[model samples]
Target: MLNFFKKKAALVWAKKHVLKSGEFKKNSVKNQEALLLSLVKTAEKTLFGREHDFESIRSVKEFQDRVPVADYEDLKPYIERVKKGQANILWTETPEYFAKTSGTTSGSKYIPISKEGMPFQIAGAQSALFHYIAQKNNADFVNGKMIFLQGSPEMEEVFGIKTGRLSGIVAHHIPGYLQKNRLPSWNTNIMEDWEAKVEKIIEETEHENMTLISGIPPWLIMYFEKLTEKHGKKIKQLFPNLQLLVTGGVNYEPYRDKMNDLLGGKVDIIQTFPASEGFFAFQDDYTKEGLLLLTDHGIFYEFIPLEEYGKPEARRLTLKDVELNKDYALILSTNSGLWAYSIGDVVRFTGKDPYRILVSGRTKHFTSAFGEHVIAFEVEEAMKATVEKNAAQITEFHLAPQVNPTEGLPYHEWLIEFEKEPENLELFRSELDEQLRARNTYYDDLITGNILQQLHITPLKKNAFHEYAKSQGKLGGQNKTPRLANDRKIADLLEIYKL
Candidate 1:
């Protein structure tokens, strides 16, 4: 009786979600403009707002003109003030929580989650699930156990505000209705050691009706591997009711083949674009290739063309000015008091009418070692094509330039952990190189000019990436291996695990 009621309620909520989303989609532009004004008005009395003269800003153009685009470093001082129990430094009120994230140059970043902005983050995730339920017209999954493999929910006090990983903070906000169905217990979640946590999770959930599983692809793959090892069966065989896989934080395409192989059956996937800064988009249509951008959310967005990124003359474009298929640096001015903040993500518009986007890559997470400027999208697409053609399955892969190789010209080096290696390794390498070259003209030019040689592939031992992550003390909880790097920091470390 309880399960029946839960499924009916879930279907009702899904129907309402679809209707609400349709209304927002039709008026996205107006919603964006109004949101910007509201954010500006709300923060007008705060330190950042006063400094930028937000009181006089009446239009999007005016706001853009008044506040320059900023990275984390630019706002570090303001965030520092907030950490020391300051109120109204950036937003109107003191932050309810700080979503701590690992940063490259800045060490640790503390992204403020405003009282007003945090609910939308939770709602975005709920809406993603609801969207799926609406499309499938089935709510059976709601009656079964669902696991979100995530960070430790344990938090520390930073002044009066709670501070923890974004995943951890979000874990605290799981809806009351879903609490009974969610697993693996709070004690299991709070375990800091990822390996131990996964073991506990396996013990707790092994016999349950795990109808939905959510996490980043790599970590979820780890969980799946552990489950299979324990049960001596494929994931689908163990949990026949498993219906959905929710993923985010990295591209899912690269991990698709391996994940499918692990599951050993069909399961729908929903990709989301989530960060400490905000929840931006999620896959609303299972048949569609792009995520539906949340226009009515607390965020107001700007797009800077990828080619013009970091240049003085870069144009900051609104939704109306954006063109389909062009890569742009995603910028945000949000109700959380972030103004013209460069989130460091690059996205491309797949549709205009309802505004769907694909996260292409990170602005900094690319290889430009030889002026090739290869982004994650290009490499992932290349790898996808190569793997499909070669009937290969990869566990994980990373690319870095071999600037001072022992043997020949410096070339791009791919360290790949293969679940199923291609029959002909050399042919696979050449085909991957060809696919990448076809996508990136600069790489093709370099190879044609003999300025650089074809990319080299290094087969890695099993659990190579796992070992790498463990070595870095980033074994789980939103940590992802860098796909491409200009330097050999990760590549050099990966040498020990080479097959």
Candidate 2:
């Protein structure tokens, strides 16, 4: 408990003193490179020493290309070593903490995190607010109690001293002073069971000053539904000072409208791109377009063309060489001693120099079952456009890729839960399909050839994903139903109807 308070105090101190260091504003790519080199040197001394004993890396590209594209499987050996109470191969010493989690597709990955890693998470988490302050310049929003809708604190004991998963470690590092009051205490303790944590959050916050809320998008949607149901109109009455809602962990496209409705459309909604591997970027602006990379912070940044990274014929690019509007897979040589680790995320650049990017999607978060590559962003766009045009009310939704071997008909199955059914869903779906096909030529050809059939809409009860997650014992904090489920196991869980 004292440690928690210390962390909170440190964070509050850092929040006032450390944010917006002029390093982030250094506009030139050269300046960015200089900043990265400095951080790399610092990490070298603090983490592994000057020689980098784990593996030799010549240049940024050489470091990237020579390293094989590995998911958590490749790193399992290192984790096993750590589990045996030995130092990991990646770094010589035991990490200050390890971000633990069962990855979306990879099951379980233990990411080594150090004391330096904590600041990045804290800074990135803080950036959401900084971005808001930069936009509105509102000092009032700065002082209020911001509620973080995060994973249960029970993760700490479950993963032990090492911060289990990125979110768990982040919870541990939340500035010590704010731990008791600002953050939801129930969710912060990893020892308590998930159900108990959720119940605790519900009980305490029913009459609290929850001005700012943060968490993964899906979990927030689920909790918000419950809050609305339990309090009726009393939600706004209880938390009358609420002004900002910050969500991440997944794309905010599907639930944006519903969240706005439930929050009375008064609060400014923000999204961030934070992960276990590292806090890559944040939506520093309101359009939620390009996530400005935290360039000057402890982590050094690098990108490789998605097509080239793993292929036999491939080359890599550094911060200096990345072209505008190109999609590249993310590779990081972080302060936590993860050298040239391919984080499986894909991002596209929007602004240059002090670079800003949009997290396009995960490399694996795509559907090519019909030879039509439909990424999460595309599906999200289509869903957003469809809902906006029909003026329909929707709480949340998911898309599952289906392949019917009998007809060889490959199409997308959309399981959507609407707050109110529009009068013309069929028309909405048809228009949405047209919009999607127009966006991607591959999808267009697939649709034209009938290789990809029409979208099948499946409406569910209002809190379906929430209840579904609850039933699975994974309801609170950072858990959310997959936005796009690719395989049979996921399909079984997400598919509400098939047509």
Candidate 3:
């Protein structure tokens, strides 16, 4: 009976999702305006609503004139007030929970998740499967457990509101019927010790019929290794039924070779763009062109040109205004009281009709110290080519500019913590450098003109990144190793494990 309901749900959502995607393709401007108007109408009585004169938002321009784009820092005061039991400060009601994100230069951030906004997050997750069912038409995957490797759901309260990691918060909302089939039992799930939790998770799920495995790429790689050590075989031998591998939070390209070696088959991968702010997009099609944006969801979309970000008069483009193939810092106004919020993600539109995007990198994370201007997406793509060519696997890595402080020709340094070491490290380094040079004209000019040294690689000791993250109290679960750093702070700290 439960299986029947699950299949029915997937098929139902698949039809509805496909129809919506098509609807947005032909009527994006109309649908987007409707969504924005609906949001304004619903929250016209809330604090932000009253302050911004939401009642006056007859058009997108009026809405933008009333609400300026802001980052999390701009709203911290309001969040703090909410933490003190304030009501209707941002949303119509007080947030029922807060999603704790990684501490920044300013310290940790607690993003409020209001009652109306929770469904948006769940909808993205469901759409991943709906797309799968719509394309593949295989509902048997639902009969078995769809194990999601995420943070534990152990809740704590602050100022009468619950708080935890976003994944943990989502875990709590998993209905009991679906909960029974999930992995990492509640006891093991709640264990704060990451190493111990991983071990117990491996022990429990080593033999289960896992049809879907979803999480960030790096941590999932670690779990795959444990499964190999446990069963002395690849994932295919362990669970041949496994069909879908969904990844988010980081690029999956560099890990493709090692993952292919582990999974050993053509398992379809569905990528998603989920953030603590809100679940934004998902790969609805088989071809990896871009992720289909959820325009009709309870989120209003905006984009600011990367060059204009943080400027006093940055032009904010609504969905109707965004152009194709242009890099822009993505902003969102959501039902969750986050109005015109810059979530810090940079993306480029791949399609304009149905509205699809490819995440570029963080607005602050890039290297242009010498005017080369390298983005994280380009770096990852270069690394992917190098890794696949060399059959190497990277556990974790960080890149930084080596300036005149090093007392020689300045260069870019790549400190890599390798799990499956490359056979020829120098060749890997040279190839990766060349790949980037080919992608960026300015970078290629510097290399050809001898203005910069060839990129250098520092092979790190095993578990070096794990140790570093552990020391920083971010051993696992949503805390990603910074891929690109403007300064030597991350590389310098990880230098202890340099070979």
Candidate 4:
């Protein structure tokens, strides 16, 4: 009787979400503009607002003119003030929680999640699930257990506010009704060691009717591997009811083949764009290739063309000014008090009418070591194509420029952990090089000019990436090994695991 009611309620909620989504789609531009004005007005008295003269900003252009695009370092002083229990430093009120995230340049970043803005974070994720339910017209998953493999929910008091991983903070906000169906009990979740936690999770959930599983792709792959090792059965055989796989943090295409193989069958996969800054987009249509950007989720967005990302005269474009298929740096001004903040992500528009986007790469995470800029999207696409063509399954891969190889011209080095090595290694390498060269004209030019040699692949031992992550003390919880790097920091560390 309880399961029946839950399904009915879920269906009802999904229907309402469809209606609401339609309205938002039709009014995306209007909603964004209004959201910006509201955010400006709400933060008018705050320190950042006063400094930027937010009170006088009446239009998007005016706001753009008044407020310069900023990265985390630019706002660190204000965040520091907030950490000391200061109110109205970044927002109108003190933050309820700080979503702590590991940063590249900055050591640790604590993104403020105000009481007013917190609901939107939860809503964006909920809406993603509701969108799936509506499109598939299937709410039967609600009757079965769902597991969100995430950070430990344990939090620490930084000043007077709670501080923890973004996933951990979000774990605290799971809707009450779904609590009963959520897996891996509290004690299991708070376990500090990722390996131990995964073991506990398997023990708790291996026999349950797991209908949905959610986590970053690499971590989820790890969990799947552990399950198969213990039971000696495919994931689908162990959990026949499993219906959905929700993923985010990194691109899913590279890992899709291996994940599907481990699952033993097909399952619906939903990719989301989530960060400590906010939940920006999610796969709303299973048939579609891009995620539906959440326009009404209390975030006002701006885009800087990838070519002009760091230029002083770079145009900050509104939704109306964006063009399809052009990569742009995603910028945000949210109700949480972030203004003209660069989230360091590069995105490309896939649709204009309803505003769907694909996360292409990160602004800082490209390899330009040889004047041939290679982004994460290009490499992942190249790897995906090559892997499919060669009948290979990769566990994980990383790319870095081999600028000073001992006995050759400078070249790109591909460190790959293959679950199934290609039959012909040299042919696989040449084909992969061709695929990447076809996508990146700059790389092709460099190769043709004899400036750089073809990329070299270093086959890695099994669980190489896992060992690398463990070595860095970032084995789990939203941490992902970068696909490519401008520097050889990660590549040098991964050398010892070479097969």
Q: Compared with the true structure, what per-residue lDDT tens digits does model 4 show for residues 65-140?
A: 8999999999999999999999998899889999888887899998999898899889989999999899988988
TM-score of 2: 0.85
User: What is each predicted model's overall lDDT from 0 to 1?
Assistant: 0.93, 0.66, 0.84, 0.92
List all candidate RMSDs to the true structure.
1.0, 4.8, 2.2, 1.0
The deviation in Å at residue 293 for candidate 2 is: 0.7
Tell me, by lDDT, which candidate is best: 1
- Cα misplacement distance, residue 225 of candidate 2 (Å): 2.1
Weakest 10 consecutive residues of candidate 4 by summed lDDT: 283-292
Model 1 bad stretches (over 4 Å): none
Error of 1 at 280 (Å): 0.6
Question: What are the per-residue Cα lDDT tens digits for candidate 1 across 57-128?
Answer: 999999988999999999999999999999999998889999998898999999999999999989999999
User: Residue 338 CA error for candidate 1 (Å)?
Assistant: 1.0
TM-score per candidate, chains pooled: 0.98, 0.85, 0.94, 0.98
Off by over 4 Å in 2: 1-22, 31-58, 104-107, 154-163, 186-196, 405-408, 496-499
The CA lDDT at 328 in model 4 is: 96
How many residue pairs collide in each prediction?
A: 0, 20, 0, 0
Angstrom error of the Cα, residue 106, model 2: value is: 5.2
